[model samples]
Target chain A: MLEHVVNGLVLGGTYALVAMGLTIQYGIARIMNLSFGDTIIAACFATYVLFSVFAINPILALLIVGPTGYVFNLLIYRFIMKPLVARAPDEGALEVDSILVTFGLLFVIQGVLLVMFGGGYTSYSFLNSPVSMLGTVVAGNRLVALVLSLTFGAVLVGVLYRTRWGMILRAVATAPQSAPLFGIDTNRAARTAFAVGGALAATGGGVVSMFQTFTATAGVVFTMKALIVVILGGKGSVPGAIVAGLLLGLVETFVAAYIDPGLTLAAVYTVFLVLLLVRPNGLFGKA
Target chain B: MTMKTSHAFLLAAAVLALLAAAPLLIPDYWTGVLLGMTGYVTLATAWAMFSGPTRYVSLATVAFFGVGAYTVAVLNETLPYPLVLLCAGGIGMVMALIVGFSTLRLAGVYFVIFTFGLAELVRQTVSWWEVNITYTMGRYVFLPFEGRHIYWQLLALAAATFLISWGIGRSRIGLALKALGDDETVAAHAGVDVTRIKLLLFVISSTIITLVGAIQAPRWTYIEPSIVFNPTVSFMTLIMALLGGAMRLWGPLVGAIPLFLLFEWLSVSFPDHFSIILGLLFILIVFVMPEGVLAKIETLRKGSPK
Candidate 1:
């Protein structure tokens, strides 16, 4: 149905937004960042509190949450991730170390959140009114979220593709060994990219809070979903994230609507497995 | 055997004999706690057997484990206990073979996530089937296993896991795996059958994990997808193995006993803050001793010349 299509796009938009952040971190910074979802969930809870207690609009909360995410991620990079980065014998060692470290970080953030928020599902009504679009009625907040997601995605793509800073980042990501030869501060680029990715995750969380119910423990679900999108989109490609995110959303929506709803997760994994088996490098990934 | 080897063997036999008699000497409450410790020790030891040398860091420990638990849960009533255990092992082996062949080619982050995804996929599929076909959320495990019986079973399994790990470390496959872990392409060039060694080790590790799950399932009384397929099991096994020094045969045992005790104490004293403490410990462990406690000890010993 047309309604399902609209819903899928809204879901896919958030997926793309989060996947972009993760791709940026993994592709450029070379940190697997299992805690990325906890950051997103933290932003969601932050937006919730701001909206409920301070009476700030969710859109306005983005201004506060996004920068906090950037700063928090930067601090984590400086404090926690720096040592692992320093002693890594090779890229493979770094990957293993990052995965273990971030996996620990995931529990740390989740534990703090659980302590602060009593392990309950939290959602607040925001822009609940439905608006007619095309031949279908859609929630006002989801539509706004989609538009915001697209706008952010577009701006990021433009920055990455059309700017010198983006060029340096791309060069570092593609060839870390040779980036130093070109006078690019690969370390600085990696830190900034990781922080920016955190900002995007926070922004995505704010967008999601407008329409979704979330729990402190649900961060892993978002992490897994974003991971799937990132890998499917080709690890570091922004445009690929957009396409793959939307594709996953559509597939999930369609499977839920046409088949049994309980099979949605299974369906997503099926698509991911088949794609991985077929193209280990992903659709747009470089070998 | 060498004199030192025979001495080590005698020491091990004496310790195991003491452990076998522990249940009769200890109170019922402590027997329960020891049972939990043995279970984790078995799982952790099996996990390190493959992950340590290969550096593959599999997160699918629960996948095979859950399969083993589910197999027993379904077949226990129809079949005898030993038969159910055999079936569980058989099913786990087949699944491991399928998963290993398909996925051993991918390494690093890709393999890690793939195993994780595979576990989640199995969990979701089982959950769906239970809801739609079985019309039940969980199954009752009515095995007549006492605390001591399960503990002894797990203890035996843990011993077997250690023996297998020790044997493998001395085998040609172990050397090949070590080479592959250092660099896959070079190992391949050096005529190591990279895929076969990986598959063999992976299957062995996974089958042991499956048996552990089967042995431990009776203690739960009720089993479900959420309980059996909990990702925490995977994470905990990885942490314990790595914390002890996965590369060493006895490292998992060294890691599991202390961490298990710490967790038990944390949960009892500060139930609400248990997760927070756990997280901090994990972070501290990885940050301070990424190579693990044994490795840290080795460095200290080297620094302090005897």
Candidate 2:
């Protein structure tokens, strides 16, 4: 039971990281950044290539991929999101448009990956190593991943609360019309949010790939799981996502271990529905 | 004669004529593609009936389609074909009503997410059931139908879709849906029973989709959880609705047929990157023509006064 609990915490850490990225983007940008999953997939592939070609250490590969993801997010915002942002605020709901556009981007990325990498699953050897944790054997890579997720999450909370940019970001998220009056360049703030969000997502993906094999189509599952975490945590609430992710991770782990693996997803979805029914605005969300 | 009524009839007749004759002219492979496209068109039209006027994108349509398929599959093994189709549609309508009642309080993105989460739940349940249960709850049972019967069944479904779309387009409820889509707050102020209207549209749309799924199952003679609950179906329907022009009577059918043909051609020519190319095309369409091809043509025609 303790082993399962540890495993759940480690898994939850990864989910929390991904969910934080999603929540941040949704909060500040008002765009779901559905392609956030693609960033993770791209980062995984990048890490894989670096490790295979340059014989780089896994930690070093993560450092390279994280920044690459940031740049990629910036590019997406500049090209795809910028033009749409300037349009009439009420012309159409941005959420639907974002879903359509980002889903299209997902398809494009997945297709490209399939063609370049083929459909087979790939894994790194170093990730397979295990470590002893208080007599409970834990995967070494997962341990590293948990630490990184928790550390990054703490840093993000500090940044959001302490920094001036974070203050402007919150202002912009609350009222885009009022933000400009306060001299906040809402566009710039949104771009920065997207960049940070993408980096976090990429970091989580890089860490997760250390423990699991993934293919081109793997992004869909991650995207779905992240969305669930975001909703369960309360939309736009970073702290809520952290708690929700851990809870969900524990639930999924227990379900997968005891019940049928097929039933585990169903159980997670059930919890999501129940949460929505009980608290429509999410656990920590502003109703 | 009212202009809207005349225009709707003309559009319906044109669509009917096209669908009726399409199989005879197209190749066998293309016929199969067309069948799939018809399903998309049917689903898109149903989606539009709810979303076009209300501006709420219900992801639960996929769940309805899945339920409809499963219902037909399960029933056809024991019951008559016609009974199976009716039961499938009835089941879909019930599910839609339940979902609509539950989530109608939420609006905009929240609604979308709610429906999406619900659909995911349905999908997970279906997956679990398929894995654990010994007896098949959602497997396709073949009804003995030949070429002409299949063609006629498709035509009938298309005709029903056209008539229903026309009715919705002409009705006050349809106008309410449109008003809701334009601005929910204003629509409510204008005396529209927002909840009832949304629930009614949701039930109507799901019923049509379930009908389509029911007939489609027998035509394919096989069904599975993945194929029935596929997000691709939702995406394809969405593309068709947007491409043809949402809220327009003939838009879905027009968009679906051509898009399916394009997909078939691309898949045949470049099987390796077909999905990628299709994705790019969708992006290009959004960038260049947000209103859609049909809407663009309409704009051009009006501007030239031809």
DockQ of each: 0.64, 0.57
| Alpha carbon lDDT of each predicted model | 0.89, 0.78
Question: Which stretches of candidate 1 lie above 4 Å from their native place?
Answer: B1-3
Per-residue lDDT of model 2, residues A1-287, tens digit only: 87888889989998999889999888888886666777788778877888888998878888888888888888988898877776626535677677777877888888898898997898887766778887798888888878988998999888887999778877876787899998888889989888888988888888877777888877766777788888888777889999999998999899988887777767776787687679877788787
For all predictions, the C-alpha RMSD in Å is 1.7, 2.8
Q: List model 2 lDDT by residue over B1-306, tens digit each.
A: 356867867876886788778878877766776677777778888787777667676666677777887777777769878788788878888888777776786756666765655555677687677667855544657788755455567668767877887787778987887788778889999999999988988898889887777777766577777677766566667777778877677777778878878777887899999768877887777777766778898788889954
Model 1 chain B — which ten-residue stretch has the worst lDDT?
B1-10
TM-score for candidate 2, residues paired by index: 0.92
Off by over 4 Å in 2: B1-34, B59-61, B115-121, B135-140, B301-306
Question: Best candidate per DockQ, number?
Answer: 1
Which numbered prediction scores highest in TM-score against the true structure? Answer: 1
Fnat for model 1 comes to 0.55
